[model samples]
Target chain A: MKTLDCLGRRCPVPVIELAKALPNLEVGDLIEVLSDDPASANDIPAWCRMRGQGFEGGSAPSYLVRRLS
Target chain B: MSYGQSVPPTTNLDSASGLPLHPAAREALLTAVDEGWADPSRLYASARRARQLLDGSRAAVASVLGARPEEITFTSSGTSALYEGVRGLASARARVGRHVVHSAVEHSAVLHAVASLDTSVVGVQRSGAVVASEFAAAVREDTAFGCLLAASHEVGTLQPVADVAERVGSVPLLVDACQLVGRAAVPAGWSVLAASARKWGGPTGVGVLAVRTGVRFAPGWPEDEHQHGRWPGPPPLPLLLASAVALEAAVMESAQEDVRLRGLVDRIRAAVATIPDVEVVGDPVSRLPHLVTFSCLYVDGESLVRALDAEGFEVSSGSSCTSSSLEPSHVLVAMGVLSHGNIRVSLSRTTTADDVDRFLGVLPGIVADLRAQAGV
Candidate 1:
């Protein structure tokens, strides 16, 4: 699992980092984002859904994702 | 129709933010400002005249809403009415149950008003309308109060207020009709309801709250003789009268305007979808006729709004970046939709077909430009 630290960040920044980080990992690799920003909780999952990546759930400040394509 | 301004902006598509006072309201206010200046509570001759205007105002607003004049209480604003509606019902039913139930997409006013109570927020579909079964399941026999919006202020989706009300049994419901009063008929089966005058091209300082005759309510504010102890002090009689006049005119023209605005909105929805990576949201079929919302991938709302303003169009946005709070709109999040790069364009009686056509032409370029700048 790879962890992207987005703590102390505001909206768009955290999701932007997540989008940027997802492309570098292997197809099956798992990634988690550490974001205190409230919008990230929903935006990250929505991004995965929109981009065809896998969303393995995690709570606020710790959203887990999987690289798929 | 003029505010005595020298230069009017090119076009305004943000009527939902608050319509500038209606021409009718403006005309009424010009005369009422002097005639309504006296205290309606006093016994003087001028005071009696003010009292007559205030009474007539309530009766006029109530007639348009299908409510009785005495049932209406003019609150300081729509938010205050929600507080009075929710808390008063719960306060009156203190022994019944502490449980309050509402749709998750309710306005922050309802959410804030119910913060102190035990509450259940029922989830909604992607289109932002609540499933009646799910909503009914959340209501308990002991539930003190329930709330639902007549239509979404953000997405303009209409809720199943009537169906949910039918299944909730005897629990008193507070229908927040702020977005529906003048746009369409407020679905029946509410024990109490609240609406904003500003949404219908009325003056800012007025909100109408109507309680059905049988519904029990304790005054949420410090008990006062004014407004049936529901609100404090005498309301701004002139503006309140103007708000009533605005609502009467709005409701009268709503049916014809409904078709006209919906045609323009459909054009916007179809036009917006052609843009790359854009998502037009809200219920396509079941929504307010004049409003449409959409989100552009990777484009921040403020940038999109600023760019549109530069192009001489004005609209509203719910994306996180536009707000000082830095939180995405709860309505969008609740619908599990994109929260960034959002715009809400709501038309009005003054918005012409030419205005919408001009907007549709510029919008795609605006989104594309913002997205390209972000390298998305």
Candidate 2:
């Protein structure tokens, strides 16, 4: 399990951090994202769909995901 | 026409926001201020002359839009037109039910108009085109009004308005043509239609609403003789005259302009796809002739717009960071696509090939540099 805190950052920033951190994680590893930006709520899940990663459900300011690709 | 800006000439790639006033419109606007200064609704000689000019303007706009003169009502703006069209249609159908149906990709004006009503929003696909079958299934017996855009205001994706109109039988549909008027063929079968004049190189603060002759629309505003009893107070004569002239002129030239601009937008779409980590949004084929939107990963939309503006190109963004409301663009959110670093470049009627060539030459480097700065 890994945690990425992007509490104060705006969108694309939180999503960018998520993308950057995801590469280092092995397949099936869990990455929990903490983003306060409103766009991040939907953008993180959208990023997962576009990037071919698994998006496990979680709410705003906190989304849980696992690396699939 | 110059406003005394320091720069020579900045390329305006934000025409979706509004095009520069049409040449015909500018001429009409200057002449109208002096010629149409009197109160048009009065019986006096000067007022009578103003009344004739107003009627002529309405007739001109009607001929261009394929509607009757009596059917057209000029509102304060495109948003106002949408409000009037939406509220009026819904009011008349109050006996039916409170339910309304609209596409998820519809402009915010439509969304806000139906906020209080029982609404069912039909979602769109990745290309921003609404699923036709899904839209048809949403229309129910109690549905009072069905709202759909002729084309998307943001992504430029052309909607299957004709199909949806056919499917939503007996449910009066209000078509918002704010994005495609004077640029594309209007899909028929709308009981009511609304559009903004600035969209077709007309002045701001002028909008058009055309209700079909037999459509059962109850005026939602207070009782007033102005604007065919649809709105209150005297109309803005000069602005409306200019808007009509611009719409007429643009429609006359639309076919030729569409082909030329479509070629330019294609060049933009193809070139934009070459940029690394960039996903060009919207339907490539069934889109507006002059607009293209693309998103770059690991980049901020506002920062990208600033960089583009600094490079002598003005563009717009739909990302949440670009809006004062801080909410992501509902259009993008509905499409379920990446909302990162989006740039919407729309070409005006005056945009030359050289302008596009210049933009293409610099866009890649800008995106690459921004990505590097973010260390992505």
Candidate 3:
């Protein structure tokens, strides 16, 4: 599992960071992202849906995503 | 009639910044420029005539604002008036305490003034209106002053000033009326009020500040004996007179224009909501009659504003994420609304139905095109 810390950063920043981190991981690898931006609560999931990836919901302020491709 | 049937009017609708200069105010200003050159403080004949005009202008402004002439003073601009009012009140009541309480969505002028003092910011509701209870709770015994806008300039949500005033008890409340004055009846129960002349059809460079009787207010700086020593130096007699005339005319036209604008704003609010991934912010029913704000997902606000301007429609965007400003709009962030692709439409007295219809007709296609290009 790869962990990306995006706490205290707002939208587009966190999503952008997540995008940058995902390319480093192989298929079936999971990335755990931590962000406090309120928009990320919806943005992460929306981004996953748009990119056709797996979004495994996590606790508040933390998101879990799986590399499906 | 559908929008395509008739050509849209040529008038642009970006009145929140300032309205077009009224003809009456223009004439008044030209006349005063010729006659109001003398120093009102001097005892000469021309000076005395200038003094009369200045005093009469103050009285006219006071009459419309429901304040006494003794309590009103003109400043260089609305931001200056706000600084004077906030700093003066805070300093006057310093012994009470240096703490100031204000809503999170106040104008930048008020926010900057509060930043110098120990400040408590009450959160606002999603509707963009301040939560009265939260605001009341933030007002402490040590609070020297409290500030609330009569209306939100960005989103046009009306604040509960009267209720917050009652809740704060004796704590003086400074109401920024830049958007409220000349558009709606001035709400009572504020200790001080400040407004900009250009927000109505008056020329810029005139800001009015009124301190209610019995409020403890000390000038922020040393000043001459003009404006009860609150504002220093000689006043702008011609601009003051023109501002008074413009305010009165706007007030007289407000009642009828309110009905017309409200209908148009309602049309906008309803139509804007129908667009994909767009959120119409602000109180749907309790907002100002002529202003509406909506934010689109997956689009940059500045780009959208530029695209609309290219279509011959003028509008303002509040998203601080614009290229010029990296920080998102504090008002939207406070309200937990999307801070991207935001557009604030403020209708002036001259905005026509054709303008609104044309904007509505063109907006959907623009948004669709932008979203497609962005691959959202």
Identify the leading candidate in terms of DockQ. 2
After superposition, the stretches of candidate 3 with alpha carbons farther than 4 Å from their true spots are A1-69, B1-11
**In candidate 1, residue A25 scores what lDDT?**
98
Clashing pairs in 1: none
What tens digits encode model 2's per-residue C-alpha lDDT throughout A1-69?
899999998888898899889889999999999988888877888888878898998987789989998
What is the Cα root-mean-square deviation between model 3 and the actual structure?
Answer: 5.8
* Model 2, span B122-197: residue lDDT tens: 8899899888789989988899989999898789999998888898878888999998888898888788999899
Residues B1-376, candidate 1, lDDT per residue (tens digit)?
8687665366888988888898999998888998999999899999999999999999998887788899999997898888889878988999998999999899999999899999999998989999998988998878998899999999999999888889987888899999888899879888899999999989988888899888988876676667867888888999998998898889889989999999999999998988876788999999998999998777788888889988889888999989879789999999998898889999999999899888988888887777667666
Ranking by DockQ: 2, 1, 3
Q: Which ten residues in a row have the lowest lDDT in candidate 2 chain B?
A: B1-10
Clashing pairs in 3: none
Per-candidate Cα lDDT values, in order, are: 0.88, 0.88, 0.86
Estimate the overall C-alpha local distance difference test score of candidate 3. 0.86
Error of 3 at B371 (Å): 0.4
Misplaced by over 4 Å in model 1 are A1-9, A17-30, A67-69, B1-10, B41-48, B221-225
Alpha-carbon shift of residue B194 in model 2 (angstroms):
0.7
TM-scores of chain A, one for each prediction: 0.94, 0.95, 0.94
lDDT per residue for candidate 1 within A1-69, as digits (tens), equals: 789999998777777777778668999999989999888877888778777889899888798999988
State which candidate, 1 or 2, has the greater TM-score. 2
Please write out the lDDT profile of model 3 over residues B129-219, one tens digit for every residue.
8888889899788999999999999999999999999989899999999988888878888899999999988999999999999999997
lDDT of 1 at B259: 96
